[model samples]
Target: MPKKLYNIDFYKFIESLDLHSFTVTDVTRYLFETYSKEFDNKKNATQFVYRHLKRLSKEGIISAIQGKSGKAIVFRWCTESSEDSELVHRTEIYGNKTNDLIVSQLQEKIRRYKTEMLMSVGETEAYSEWVQEMPDFAEYVKPHYQNTREQAKLMLGKVKGFERLLAEHEARLS
Candidate 1:
């Protein structure tokens, strides 16, 4: 059976926001713990996040609820349109343009293909060539796991290097 890919972006957007009104301290904690969706800065907190949250209010995703004494702003999730669901009867607010399901699927496919390629190509040199392509391959793959698929098709569009390497390994073993 095939695995179902979930739409995480709608949830991600909700996760990114401050559900309740927050002061400087609460905002800091929210940014640090829950959402890495970029609150102006991931590492530092200052007027940047506060300012941006204010801007978000203008976009209708958040509303600045002014109480009697303390000014507390509660941000609401805009569930308007099929973007969130078919149940939205309100105005559109702060949903992103596209969901992250596609990006996640693409990455998963790439990973599965790479694993298959490694099993098929049976030589260190061929594997090494493939692993050397990604800009962040070193960080992504473990230290012991070294394989890549960048040294691509020949002028004839065949994976000649990989085939040659695999054959060389076979011949040596024989």
Candidate 2:
């Protein structure tokens, strides 16, 4: 039998953080220290904390501000007693429809690039066959065939990147 996965109400967890503003790293460390026994390791606990924070921010349950260096993200807890209702309103607007639009665009790009890569593969195969049948034209066909393969590789790379982006967006939606 498989172990069942349990869902944690992260909003409640965040609420228990006691209305204190904290950086993502600080939150991760705090969770890891509090629930060290529940997780296999600190890294796993940290990742879990990050996942919840992202979901909460995306759903407008919390507000995140980019740090001065632009790499560190500080998350502010939202509560009924919060002083800045306007800031909360702005945060609510953050993940509304723009994420969906970006996800849709990324999916479309992934689909188109995948199809192009397949076509490029077919063209490369045809070129190889032509070169085999006509040795004299091999010089002319070889460079084009290589170029097509390179193009296919680039397209595949793009598809992977777009797929990753789509997954991130979907995670936020979830």
Candidate 3:
């Protein structure tokens, strides 16, 4: 069974850090390889950063300041708190309404998906094409058919009498 990833208290940890603020990319790489060593799915550094910023902003533990370059949100930790303070209550700077928009979009997608799954396909569409039409599935499988000649040859070699196999397969289909 695959392990479930619980949402982390990313903001609290951000608060714990001594720096005024840091880049999300830098933080995620640190979190993935360093703190969250057990979790290896760190490829979405931007998502991780966005989610953490949203979480932290909701709690008021951190604030997103205009980046040094301008127009970018560089997250900076709060400094007004007393040095001895431990219990911090961070409220969502951006409200559930923002999150609601995302949820509603996802819900709309799920509704569309359920509706789509229940519907029949066009006469010209193959089942593989149907699956590949999905954004996630399409992106996931786009590279699947991208084998180089050498790799294709290697894969072909792995088959037991692939030529004969194809002939038999065609015969069976016929």
Candidate 4:
């Protein structure tokens, strides 16, 4: 799938453009002139603008106005719909660097906790079976098994907390 590029920079760039209608070529030229460092070449920059224009049109962020000849497509920045503007704002917030960092950290913590829980469960089960067959070794193995169980419980608690935090963040975004 094509990577979505509705990032803060893109949002700001689109916002900076004139409200009047513009052709893809006009937008591409403007982008190349204004932010040449962002694109490797004019061709790539033009492609990026084309894709962005199509996406924005689909999202109702911009309206495409067909010209007289039917060959020219002029795009005008659209803000007539409050819902579309709100969606754009929310998208910007979700793509913010701080939110991205928090999301990454939460995902990492959740993954680590899940792995630890699986390992703890495996160890505890092994110890339980070993203790059942060998009662003489129960005293030595029981403590370790108990420790694993406790660790697993703690991990589960942490996982639940992280999940709640993530859900709250998502709710706020929505």
Candidate 5:
């Protein structure tokens, strides 16, 4: 039941803003504070704002300029349309085979797998320490330790495979 940013009226959000130009961080913080219940967390708010900004740029309502730091992007409101401007949604954006949703979903999966792998590593270490402290319990702890290590290995493989797939998908889109 996650809230998707594409469903929100981002065009109206942009129009309501007083700033002519802003970075994603600025918009993310504003939205996170204004729509705390909807977003639930800063990360979710940031992703929602970033997606909307990208869609705005794509629709020509805003222009993305290079920021002082070469890697940073700044979005400037380029159009002076009336209040009834057409709302920009992800319907068009997600129509393509390789879209933001797919890329973000893949990245989220990779992050989850990496996190689980790290947790598994921690569990393996704890089990190793327990076994060293009490050799008599080695027989009981061996299965758990081995299973955690194997799961960590499996997670690593999954992460690498997904990363490769993501790269190939991005390359194809490019």
Candidate 6:
């Protein structure tokens, strides 16, 4: 027998938390701790959890019960007899929208980073070329050239990381 394939679903995770009320902070901590593989860091985990919380509230699956107290907004799941089907429908719709938003944002970041990367490339070239053509200033320009090259390397890593995430998200959608 072969094992079945499975992917972690954020909506399902939220639904599994059978709590009467919960705050975004609480959920974020739990999510970040439990799904360390899915998220790169706590900040990303918090953002993902927050996005779903807002969507769930908008869909009436959850309602805000706090925040008027000047504290974290707590949410309560609205349980009803028809919740299963309705929950599935609402989450499915909102989930796709959320995913689409994430994809678009990632694309924008990739574009911005690529632009910066190109600028860094030009700076790196200019600095290195200046060092050879103007040997008297090489001592001062060498450090700048090395710094620009290092920055370009870091930006390339970030671009690759974003591309990997984009691919994973697209694959999940299909």
Best-performing candidate as measured by TM-score: 4
Q: For candidate 6, list the clashing residue pairs, or say none.
A: none
Order of all candidates by TM-score, from best down to worst? 4, 6, 5, 2, 3, 1
lDDT of 2 by residue, 1-174 (tens): 553232555555666777567776787676777666777777676677777789768766677889889899888865633436635665657656677678778988999999999999999999999999998999999899999999999999999988988888788789
In the order shown, the candidates' Cα RMSDs to the true structure are: 19.3, 12.0, 21.8, 6.5, 13.2, 14.3
TM-score of 3: 0.39
| lDDT of residue 109 for candidate 2 | 97
TM-score of candidate 1 relative to the true fold = 0.29
- Per-residue CA lDDT of model 1 for 45-101, tens digit only, reads 435445656765665555566555566544444443134452232232222222234
Instruction: State every prediction's TM-score relative to the real structure.
Output: 0.29, 0.45, 0.39, 0.54, 0.47, 0.50
| Clash-forming residue pairs, model 5 | none
Q: After superposition, how far is residue 60 of candidate 3 from its true place, in Å?
A: 2.0
Task: Write down the TM-score for model 4.
Answer: 0.54
Sort all candidates by lDDT, best to worst. 5, 6, 4, 2, 3, 1
Error of 3 at 62 (Å): 1.0
Q: What is the C-alpha local distance difference test score of candidate 1?
A: 0.46
Which residue pairs does candidate 3 place in steric collision? 58-91, 58-92, 59-90, 59-91, 60-90
- For model 3, how does the per-residue alpha-carbon lDDT over 52-143 read when each residue is reduced to its tens digit? 67776656666777787875677776664443432533223244455556556545554554444333222114434745576567555445
| Residue 43 CA displacement from its true place in model 4, Å | 5.7
Give stretches of model 6 more than 4 Å off.
Answer: 1-86
lDDT of 5 by residue, 1-174 (tens): 866644567667766778888999998877777777887678888888888899778776789999998877999976645543433334344456347778999999999999999999999999999999999999999999999999999999999999999999899878
Residue pairs clashing in model 4 are: none
> What lDDT score is found at residue 25 in candidate 2?
78
Q: Which candidate, 4 or 6, would have the higher lDDT against the true structure?
A: 6
- The lDDT values for all models are 0.46, 0.77, 0.54, 0.81, 0.83, 0.82
